[model samples]
Every structure is written in C-alpha cells, then in structure tokens.
Target: MWYYTLNGQQAGPVSQAELAQMLNGSLPSDTLVWKEGMADWLPAQDVDAFRNIEATPPSQTNGSNPYAAPNSIVDENIKLSGTDEIPATPIPLDIGFCISKSWKTTIACFGAIFLTWFVYILITSIVGGVLSTIGTAIDGPVAVAPITEGMTQQAPFLPSHNQSINQQTGTGAIIAGILNNIFTMFLGLGLTLIGLNLLRGKDTNLGQLFGQSGTKLFRLIGASILYGLMVGLGLVFFIVPGIYLGMRFMFYQTVIVDKDLGVIDSLKYSSSLTRDNKWRLFFLFIINCFIVLAGALALIVGLIWALPVAWLTLLVAYLYLHDGERSLAA
Candidate 1:
C-alpha cells in the first residue's frame, strides 16, 4: 500500500498500481509519496518506482491539467509563512504520524529536554513555596472564641476579626496566583522556543529558556491574555464554545514565536491554520492525554518523560498542520 500528499493532506492506502493510476502523470514530480516501512515522505521524483511515470503533456489534457499546482503566489524569501500556498479549504491531519515522530524526537533529545523541564519545575516550586509562606505570615492564624450556651450566633451582617483575616488571605492568594502565572508563562514561552529549535535540529541550551525579550515578549503576553479571556468567557457561557475556541487558537503561541506575528495577527493566523481540522486535533489531544496518563502510572517519575513527549507531540502537530510533512524532521 502507498500514500501520497495531495494539496497538503495525506491520501491513500491505495495499492502501488492504483496510486500510479491516480497519479497518471498528472501530479507534479515534487509531490511527496510514502508507504509503510519508509522512514519518511520523499518527493515522487526521488522514489525509484515513480521515475518511469511521464507527465501528461498539456496538449493531451484537454486544455486544462487537473493536477497542475495552484497559482498562489509564494514569497520565496520567507521561510515559515507558507500559508499563501496552502488551500483555504480544510486539510487532513495525520495523528499517528505526529505521535510516532514526537516519540522518536523525545528519545533523541531526552537529556536536554528533561534537564530543561527539571529546572523550570525547580524554579516554579521554590517561588511558589516562598509566596505561600509570605501569604501565610501576612494572614495570621484565626483565633476561635469559646461559645457560651447563651451566646447568640454572630450576626450575618457584622464584620469580625476572622472575616477580616479571611479577606486579607484571599487578596494575598489572588496576588500570588497572578504573579505565579506570569512567571510560569515567561518560562513556558522560552521552553516552547527551545522545542521549536529542537524540532528544526538546531542547537539548544539552558539559556534559551530566557531567550524571549522586547516587543516579541510583549506580543506573546498580549496574545496570551486575549486568548485566555476569550476562552474563559466561552467556558462561562457554555462548555462547548470554550472547547471550540481552545482548539481554534491552539497554535497562537507557536505562530507568535516561530513567525514573529503580532498578537491579533497570531490569533487570526492560528484560527486560519486550524480551520476544518478540529476533530483530528481533538483526537490527538486525547491520545496525548493517554500518553501522559501512562507516564503517570509508571511511577510519578514517569512525568519526566511523559510531559515533554506530550508537549513535543503537540508541537509536531503544529508543524505538520502548518507546513505538512515538509516542515517535519525525518
């Protein structure tokens, strides 16, 4: 059985002869073709089996070649914005290919990725612990008054020492939570940047965790805020819309980091990129959930491996959807 890429979607399980018949010398030689046991997709021209196939001459195809490449104009200098060449109609996602590829990458770079995650966790934990301690100290322990048989229950409208303490504690907790989230977001952006570099086979090190800065950092934060508010609002109104928007804007971070798109532009691009592929994305999410759960089951330490694999799998999906198999590392 063989499979081929047609307009950025995987198409087949067709027999070799059937694929040949379908190609009929109509598709471009650069179209990617693959079959089980092959390591990765290769241009049809590079495969031995397709060399003998000849293009159907323009004169023979009744004035129009059905397989002619789209007329979309692509900027040759831009490395990542291949969207111009992609069809606006929905594209198919290969979930199995994503997971398998992500697993292989995880194995290949386990040491660096694991160490990066460990440092992130360590910093987050220490800061969180310090914040909790400060909050506790600020909201001293509540004193309980002994109840007398005749003592009336405290009036609902009356303010008491306990209530004041509770209010102060709540305020402190909220502040702590906000600070923690911002810090984590900063670290996460850097971590994701590292993942992208790793995906491209670029060298990565610990310092990359703090690689983001200036206008790009601000844009990422702005996009994140908008994304969170929109998703939260959807979740508040109804659970379904939240899930829908969540999947729609899933690639915002990647777009911001990889393409240097502005906040609103990143959101728009993510929506465009994810259009018509939500179901497959959802399935991939579920599969990653299982992978994480399995890792959790293998002693809590398994998270060291599970978490990165899950994250890398999503990144793999992003690359696949953004540029098809071409952007993926073999």
Candidate 2:
C-alpha cells in the first residue's frame, strides 16, 4: 500500500501501481510519497517506483504529457498552469466530499489562516483607534450642566452641548467603521484567494496572503458589491428570488480571484457556471451555515475550525463548478 501527502495531510492507501499512475507526470519531483517497504516517507523522485517518470518541467507545453502511460490517471480536461510544474485536473466534487476535504485542509492550515485574520483585525483596529482619537480631538470635550435632583435632561436631539459632542463622536465612529469595512473587504479578497489555493493542496503563508494578487482586487470588490445589491433588491421583491440570486452569483469572487476577470464578466461567468446547480449550491450553503453555527455554539472556539472549513468547502465547490461548466461548453 502507498500513501501520499497533500496539503500536509495523508490522503491515500492505494496500491503502488495506482499511486505511481496517479502521480507520474502529475506531481512535482519533491512531493512526498511513502509505502510499506520504505523506512520513512521520501520525495517521489527518490523512490524506485517513480524513478522512470521525469518531473514535468515548467516550460512544458499546455498539452497532455507524452510520457504518460496508456492508462495514466491524468484527466483529458486537465489544463496546464504556467506557474505549476504539474497541471491541476479539476474533478467534479460532491458537497459531502468537499466538506470533508475542506475540514481537513482547514485543520492542516489553521495556523496560517488564524494569523492572516489576526493581522487583518489588528491593522484595522489600529486604524480605527487613530481615527477615533482624531475625531475626539476635533470634537473637544462635552460640558455637562449641573441639574437639581429629579430634573430630567429631555433634550434628545435638540442640539444641546452634550448632544453636539455625542453626534460628532457618532459621526466619527461611523466614518471609522466605513473605513474598516472597506479595508476588510479588500483584505478578505486576498485571503479568500489564499484559501482557494489550500483546496488544491498548496500551503500558503502570511506573506502570500498580503502580497496576493491585486491585479483584480477592485474588480472583485465591485462584483461583490454588485452581487450583494442584486441579492438585496431581489429580497425586496420576495425571499425566493433573493435566495436564487445568491446561489447564482455565489461564485463571482471565485471567478474573479481565479481568472482575474472583469467585474461584469465574473458575474456572468458565475451565473452561467451555476445555472444547472443552483439548488445543490443552495443546499450546500444551508448545510455550511448549520455547520458554522454548530461550531459557534461550541463556546466560540469551534468557529476557529468551522469558519475556514466553510470557506474552503466553497472554494472546492467552485473548482468543480468551474470544471463542470467547461465540460458542458466543450
């Protein structure tokens, strides 16, 4: 039996032949592999079973591997990535399968995910604090007049001195909140993209989270806002329409982050990709909500595990939907 590690998790117990076939020209030379005869796990290239298979070079053309055996496990629809040595073959994934994979990936990459969110919160807090302080300085102190016992200060919105100060503070807080929300939205785009990578068994670091591609950040943000507005407007008409729109446009961010597409194009692509699977996606979303709620009920500690799992599950689903759409089109 052979076992392989992906995204820092052990993923198989297949025969040597299947493992070799699955991995030959499909993974990097340095990817870890192990079997019963081995003392410990080693890189695929170092193992005798895989010595005959050469690692696919980065410069290889965007076509099927010539060296692959007749019954190689590589899928015909697999597309070559210029950045990755081995092409990633997207397979149609079921909700249950993705949920399981998402949980595993989340657990494996917990430290990185937690640190990324922590840094985001910390920076936003600092900015909000600075804004609050500046707002306070500008507003100056509020003067409170001495009142006899039982005399009620009934001026709620009459522009009293205290009311003025409170209003200014409220305005400042609102401004700071808006700024924080904007920053979080952009930061979250990058984090979401990092989570997407985790679904493919890639280990992501904090540096990558911050420096992640911003080539389509604004477009992503725009698409997100547009989707939200569409959903909101649909809800105004009725509940079912909103749910429908939500499911349909759910993958807008995924398309934007993965394809670096324009705002409108990402929305259209997401709509098309989700056309036949809206009900499945809707149920998936409901299940995930329950999963996260269950995690939150576990003294709030479970959210640390649950939230990442939910995010990764959606990414995995997006990958499948993306592949499914391509196949249908072809």
Candidate 3:
C-alpha cells in the first residue's frame, strides 16, 4: 500500500515506484487524467482544473482498481537488444545510486599509481649509483659524475643498455625502465582492485583492497593490463568510436567482481551490455564524462578537477546500471 499527493488531490494504494514511472512517461500505454492532487491522472467523472492542496492526510485506506484491465490482446512491442535478449538499463549521469563514499576508492586507485612511480624512481636511483662507482675506475677520478645511464660501451662487462636514463643512456638503463614499467603494471593491479571494491559499494581501503594475498589480487594486475590495452584499442577506431568503446567497457570491473569473469569475458560482457543502448549510453556519457572533456579542452589545468569529477560520474554510471539491472531482475 502506497500513498502520494499529485496536483491538489490525494491518492492511495498505487504502487509508488511503478506509478511514478508510469507518470513519468516510462509506461507508454497509460494515459493519465487529472483530479485534485493528481492533475495528471484523474477519472472522467472527477476531471477538474486547478489543483488544491489538502493540509490533512488523506484517508489511510487502500483501494482496488475501480475498473479492471481488460483481457484484450496485448502488443508484444518491446524491441530486442541482442542475441541473448538481455535488457540492460541506461545509466545516465543524473541517475541515482552513486555515492560520495567512493572517493576513498578513487584515492586508493590513484595512490597505486603514485606509489609505483615513487618506488621505480627509488630503485633506478640506487642502481645508477652502483654503476657510477664502477665507471669511476677507468676515468681516473677527475671529479667523477654519476653514470646516469645503466650500462654502455663504457661499462661493457655490465649489461649494455640502449636507452637513456637521468644522464645515462644504455641497454642496462632501458632494462631498468622496463622493470619500472613492470612495477607500474603491478600498481595498475592495485587500481583495478580498488575500483572493483568501489563498484560493490564496499568500505574500501586502498592497502587492504590490493594487499598481497591471493590469486584475486594478481588477477587485478591482469585486469589492469587488459584495461589499458582496451582503452588504447578503443582509441584506435577514431574519436567517437573511442568514446563509445570506453563506455561500453565501463563495466569491466563490475563484471570481474560480481560475475567472476576473466579479463576477456569481462570486456566481452561489458561490450555486449551496450548492444542497442549505444546512442543512449553515449549521450548520457557526455553528461557523466563532461568533466573529462572539459579538462581536455582546458589542457592541463582543468585536469585536476576534471579527473575526479569524471571518476565520480563513472561511479555514478556503474551504480545506476547495476541497480537498475537488479531491480529489473527482482
């Protein structure tokens, strides 16, 4: 039993959520009439003009459908989306289910990035010092400068590098940089874990989310690599295609968490969810990701604000989509 006041007349017994959607144009078949509180939905006998508010609560009584719906032939008008006939809900930026509680998760994700950078810098600095000591022997100590490069012909016995680091250029340095990339890849794992926990609306602590624990933690590392690859691939087809791809694969984290799918399956499922709702999802994505666009337009300065806002909107979209799916299933 539900009650609501529409226009000036009071009504009772309407399923609130269902009726709200009907009133909001979701139920295409229902034509609403007007009464006092419900200027939108009134019976033919009670049609009136201006609605008046009643300070008093309406009778605490439930009512049945005065006129039963006819058992007439109904049209099977709903359009199908994909081969499996899955009906994923549209996730607009303005929709409900997003939370401010997600900021911690966002922080955690970014923290992984920062932590990786710091660690890589530290390791390279240490390794550079050792090589600099070895290089000093041949140069005869004339105010020795650090061998910023990992290894070169100058230190052929040590692994030779073909890349530049700090002030050193060699094969060894490039190998160190490669190792740093690997470190960052691990950090990306941390970000994926935090993101998944955030999607679940869980109390996410960055350290805890990616703690050295089990296979799930390592799987996050793989997902992060896949995510980066997908993002790059998404950009390969042109701008609009890239944007669409981003939105289509937005559910990868959720797919991994709730569905326990592999990286490829998560990407596949996320893509499939957008089958027929591409345009709708694209338009809504504009709203949710407008901050990102704005930041891009602003160049560097806008990035500070844009990144966080875009992330929040992303969280919002994820929640809206998942909640809607749950509700529809229920």
Candidate 4:
C-alpha cells in the first residue's frame, strides 16, 4: 500500500493494494519514494522520484465507507481509466528466449555418446558378423537374408513396404543405424541433464554435461518413457489429456535439479505446480518459441548465436527459482 501527496495538494495517500489491483502490467517499484522530515512530499530517495508515500494500514479506509479507501473507487483505479489500452511492456515472445538453447544445450550435453560409443559400435559389428538377425517389425521379417518381395503388414499398425535387409551390403549401415537408435533411446536423459545444467548456468561441455546429466539419466529416461506411454494413451482422446499432463509436469527438470526429485516425483511435482498455472506456462512456451523459429529461419548460422543467449536468459529465471532454496539452505 502506498500514498503520494503530489505537489502539496494532499492528492494521495494512494494504497499499494489498490495499485496492485489496478495494475494490468509490469509495475516498476522504483516509482515511489520516501521523504525525510516531511509528511507532504520530498524526494525521499531521488530528486525526480515522487516522495512522502505512506503505506496505508491494511485495516484502514480513506473513503466515506470506512471499509474501502479513496483510490479503491473504480474510476480512479488506473492512471487513465475506461480506456482500452495495452500497457508498455514488451510483446513478450516467451518461447523465443530459450527453446533453442534448450535444444543446443541438450545437443552439446549429449555429444558424449558420439565420443564414447564409436568403439562399441565397431565391436558389435565384429561380434555379430555372419549372424542371421531376424526381427519382426511392421514387416514379417526384417532379416539379414535378403528378400525382394513386399514386406508383410502387421496387425494394429501400418503395412511395411518392400525393403531388403542384407548382411553383405547393409551391415555397416545397419550397425550405424543401431548405434544411432541407441543414442536416441538414451536421448531423453542426456537432453534433460544437459538442459538442466544449462539451466543452472553451468558450462555444458561433453564431459560435464554427460557426467552431471548421468546423475538423473536413468530416472529421467524412465520418466520420459512413461510420459511417452501416457501421452500415447492420452492422445487417443485427441490429445486433451496429454496436453494437460505435458503442462502439468513441464517443470520436471527444475524439480530434478533444484529439489533433487526423482523422475517420477518430478513429474508428479510439476503436474501439481501447473494445476492452475498450466495455460499461462504453456502460452509462455508458444510465445518464446517464436525466437527459435526465427533463428531457424536465419539458417544454422543464426541458431549458433541465438541458441546460447536465449538459453542463458531463461536460465536466469531458473536461477531465481532456486535462489529460495539457496537462501533457505544458507
């Protein structure tokens, strides 16, 4: 609650609560001031700022009703009332700030697999040499013995086209493919850990990102797999439920990092936090995501610059978020 007696006219005695109610946009705090040895007005903190503002006792009223204050009156609420005007804040392309960085951080974070798994890929090829591998996918048999006929379609899913799998020609390709799949399968944890490190304002080189990320790797992987299955289940209802769950647990990374929550706990905790704030958080993603798009439109070059800056900016919020924990622990 604040009061301003402007230019000795005793104009206010404005209440901060009333201002809070009236403010539809970002309200700068430095606008108010305190006066020394003066009740009416003096530049309490600075020369240009307004002064002698007093906090109206929360229980008191300044108006005739004795229950409500003067600025509590509807028309006087805004500096200009009854006007359809947007406040002077930015258009707030929310996602523009960080989505790319999240991806980049994850990419860098996951760079360790390429570093660590190359030798393993070579070893697997040598061990599996001349072995006939048969697998049932959409095709009846994706086998090493080559077949030219059209692949059989499977039940409960789409049909496979005629594609040959040959041990002789496709072996290298197949090994590379398998290794790629391994990287992708483990991607959930790698990305989240690296992204979380990025969120914590840490340098996410291949080693640290992978190492720190490994702390929550398996747990996040399981959570991601579960989230995937849940999404698949929920999407049968045209995605309403899936969307709800996504927003609800979207903060799981933060939970995992700051609170040291396990994957499942982070998911549950995020869902709880977003119970009421889902739409707002979801929209924040949509708005900030545009910056990512703009970067993509600029080609990979723009992405190189936009990605880190945007990620660091969002990390600022994450930093503030964990500050409470830091303070409490301190």
TM values, all candidates: 0.67, 0.62, 0.42, 0.43
* TM-score: model 1 vs. ground truth: 0.67
Please list the residue runs of candidate 4 whose C-alpha ends up more than 4 Å from where it truly belongs after superposition: 1-161, 164-206, 213-215, 309-330
Candidate that would win on TM-score: 1
- TM-score for candidate 4: 0.43
Compose the digit string of candidate 2's lDDT tens values, residues 147-252: 5466456753344666656756676566766666766667777777777766665667766556645667678678878998999998998688999999988887
lDDT comparison, 3 vs 4, better candidate: 3
Best by lDDT: 1
Model with the higher lDDT, candidate 1 or 4: 1
| Better candidate by TM-score, 3 or 4 | 4
Ranking by lDDT: 1, 2, 3, 4
Q: Which of 2 and 4 is the better model by lDDT?
A: 2
* Tens-digit per-residue lDDT, 198-262, candidate 3: 45555556474335334544554576677767678778867666677776776666555545566
For each candidate, C-alpha RMSD in Å? 9.7, 12.5, 14.0, 14.3
Model 4 per-residue lDDT tens digits across residues 27-89? 222223222223443222332322233423222223332112233332221222211111222
Question: What global local distance difference test value does model 1 have?
Answer: 0.73
lDDT of 2 at 6: 58
